[model samples]
Target: MTAAPHVPVNLADRLSRFSDLWSQKTVAGVNDYEVKIAKLKGEFVWHRHEDTDELFLVISGRLTIRLRDGDVVLEPGELFVVPRGAEHCPVADEETAILLLEPAGTLNTGDAGGPLTKAAEPLD
Candidate 1:
């Protein structure tokens, strides 16, 4: 076995490689967590992670994390963590770029699996 190369990841460059909405692209990994990126627009399914928290960091545009209680709005360079088991729906009025930090293999659709579910593939 060999160690993976340590290198800097350019978020903008990685984001540019993909144009699909709601699809996650894995950019890097740390321990048991994966650093992923996605472009979001409109609304996403309401879902919850049963075992791990989900972190969403807005890279560009605006993101509204709709919770059962209310909504958490994030601007560029801002981030929010949705606690485990808490249901959330992410929405964006325009094309929004975001970075996600979660456990490896965590599903994008969480507890609500459907057509929008996407496995995070490595960026190319």
Candidate 2:
């Protein structure tokens, strides 16, 4: 497929295209990584990316990254980078929108594949 050139990606506009929690859609690609967006709520399975860092940027609402030591809370416009191999589970009290950055083929659920795992789909 040919890339859509010169067009800007509007995060909120792209995010509105889906309502499923934990569903990820690839909005753009940067070299070997993909810029993805997801709507999140409740708790996600505990997992970790063994080879690549995961960046979570809150576009709207709040999210808590639950780590073994403690939890990192992120509000709108905030971001957190979970280092490679660091175990984490994301929790949101309310519906939240987020942007994720990781290697193109990185699994959303890491090694803890289950119902929450989502294969990246192209942005519609």
Q: What TM-score, to 2 decimals, does candidate 2 have? A: 0.95
Q: Relative to the unseen true structure, what is the Cα RMSD of model 1?
A: 2.1
Candidate 2 residue lDDT tens string, 3-93: 4787788887888778888888999889988999999999999999999999999999899999989999999999999999999999999
For every candidate, C-alpha RMSD to the true structure in Å: 2.1, 1.2
Off by more than 4 A, model 2 = 1-3
Task: Mark the regions of model 1 whose C-alpha exceeds 4 Å error after superposition.
Answer: 1-6
- For residue 82, what is the lDDT in candidate 2? 97
Which stretch of 10 consecutive residues in model 1 shows the poorest summed lDDT?
1-10
Consecutive 10-residue window with the lowest summed lDDT within model 2: 1-10
Residue 18 C-alpha lDDT in model 2: 84
Q: Clashes in model 1: which pairs?
A: none
